[model samples]
Target: MPLRPETARQVDALVADAQSAGHVPSLIIGVVRDGALAHLAAAGTQPLPDADLQYRIGSITKTMTAVLVMQERDAGRLALDDPLRRYLPEAAAAGPVTLRQLLGHAGGLQREPDGPWWERSEGVDLAALLAGFSVTKVAHPPHRVWHYSNLAYGLLGGALERVTGTPWAQLTQERILDPLGLHRTTYAATEPFARGYVLHPWHDTLREEPRTDSRAMAPAGQIWSTVTDLARWAAFLADPDPAVLNPTTVDEMCAPVILSDLDAWRGGYGLGIQLTRDGDRVHVGHGGSMPGYVATLAVHRPSRTGVVGFANSYGFRTGGIGPLGHQILTHVLDVEPVPTRPWQPAEAPPPADLAPLTGRWWWMGTSLDVSWDRATGELVGILRGDRVSRYAPEGPDRWRGVSGVENGEVLAVLRDEAGRPAALDVATFVFTRDPDSEP
Candidate 1:
């Protein structure tokens, strides 16, 4: 279904405002919910920005590289902790850095390759990239900090080639773009692509930016995409398909491994993905930039909703490109929130074993409730009425927490002299039938 007329107007207004403020040649924005594009709008064009028109996604390409890396991990080709030298034995300088460190941008490699800014200049091949690697090439020690290294991703692509004997671009097409049906995404600019430009600070004149093939650094930021394709990618990040990539693996990729914003902690880096705190909601996504293009893709996972925005100008003075997607998507959510469905009775009764554990128990003078989710057939543990954890029955008298505070913890059932259920040992905290019972 399309957005309401008033809501569409609001979205258009937001994009138009951003385009005017940023003074970009053109801008396009798209929003998705529940794996579907809910809204698509463009500003700065007379007719309208076509959803299929391509725009440089820049470092957003890193997200796809990360997914490909995760796919190799899921297939058991290598472990995340394996050192880079395990695959590329030639890089003695980057030998000690692990795949996990590179994925999380904590390997302390320099921010870019050893040439004249790979983003603006013609990219060198893997051999040239690796040949420059030396002990002094490292800016900081491994695992020192989240350094945002494009060079890391370039190395990842090279490592993948060694492991699979296939090129990075072809591997990506086979594993991701084709699987996801993202026909609009490609390694280079195609027809109907937006022309990138650098916005003049004082005047409104714009200078066209050169287009270069990032041969080796392509994994870092070298793809061209459209709002439509980006919206789909955003949805994939929010709710991934088990066929293309495991949802658990996606979760691992989104987990904050290091803080990029340091003390502020407003922004963090996961395994190639980026996490940002916007008010109470934390968004999982990545931002991209090259010489003349800026783009962003963000998803509010809880809502299964995401936003994508692109600007065809570099160094946007108004700073709209950074927050444009979030602002537009949040506004859409605010006006047209995802409708809630009424609760329905479970298909079957709670398991008989749940009877003994159901209802309220006392834990250090506080109440803990154990309930069964018939829909998922998992145990829902609520502490003091609010903190919730979901558990799966592990074995006899044992339940393992799958989420929340009890994650990875086991809840064991204690029995009395007569073999009657007595107390609960959750995360090593004793919960008893009586408030005053001693551990």
Candidate 2:
């Protein structure tokens, strides 16, 4: 379905605001809904008069890299938990940093090991870049905390190269871009790329910024794409085709792994995407920032709605893109905004038989609390430190929660030889009921 006129106006208003702010020379915005390009608009200016010029998408490239890694995993070529050293022996000394940790930004690595290479244009050999690892200290133990690190993704790029014996750029093209028919998207070195611009902080001049050669950090940030191309990418994310990424795998990528409360934006970090909540809606996507450009791409997966925005000026920071994207979504959906709320399980009143699930669950070495409300006849699982959530009875010994991070998921309690509830499986997390609780 096409976007309503009001939604179009909202997009135009945002572009106009950026233009009025005077730093943005050009912007291309696109919206995709239900597997189609619902709307696409280009305002301001591109160096040339053509509409096909490509802009550097920056860290958005990380999302693509992540998807490729997931593809490799799906093919049984790799595993998310596989140690980086499995592919690159040199990284063996870096300890037990796994590919999963890198995807989640939980692999204790520096934000940028060699510093700001884009601004200085200081190039380093691949070996020197890797050797700098010695100076790179882990901020926290693996998976304990989320520390955004460009170097970790750079390492992942190296790991992918070692595993596939191909460059990261080529891997992305072969695995993702080509399959999706994104003819206009490619690495920066590829032709027809837009020249990024940086507005002078003090002066009213726009200076052409040097294009970065992100070979070292290529996987972390180095891809050129157009609004049209990105819309297609967004569509895939909203409703993935198994040929691209298994729907289950895509859902896993969107699942929140680390919680964050920054500014007024409260959300979590998924594999390569940011999991954000706007009132009752949840969105998954990533933003991009390079020397002279800032871009945002986000999608409400359940609604099949996505918004893509790009600006030509760098150093222009506004509380990231989540808020603006959310506004756009709200306009499109024509829904009233509500306060953000954590996902909660449903409640069942007393007197129903609740003997099936009474015990414990474990995921990643953490135990989850499971109990049954005998009076209400409901099964509940507490995500360790998380608030209690009620599960709705599905069918004999099966139940499902309200589906907020774990939507469409079913939990089943396993029975022992004595027909006692001994283990419970809730989607991905598996829990073993306490032996003593077993009746």
Alpha carbon lDDT of residue 107, candidate 2? 80
lDDT of 2: 0.74
Number of the top-ranking candidate, with lDDT as the measure: 1
Candidate 2 structure quality by residue, lDDT tens digits, 51-157: 36688787888899899899888889999999887887766666888898888888877677665564326445456567745524566778777789888888888
The residue pairs that clash in candidate 1, if any, are none
Question: How many residue pairs clash in all the candidates, one count each?
Answer: 0, 7
Per-residue alpha-carbon lDDT of candidate 1 for residues 325-390, written as tens digits (9 for 90 to 100): 878767776788777989888777676767788878897688889889877768899998899999
CA lDDT of each prediction against the hidden true structure: 0.87, 0.74
Distance from true location, Cα of 68 in model 1, Å? 1.1
Off by over 4 Å in 1: 1-5, 46-48, 417-419
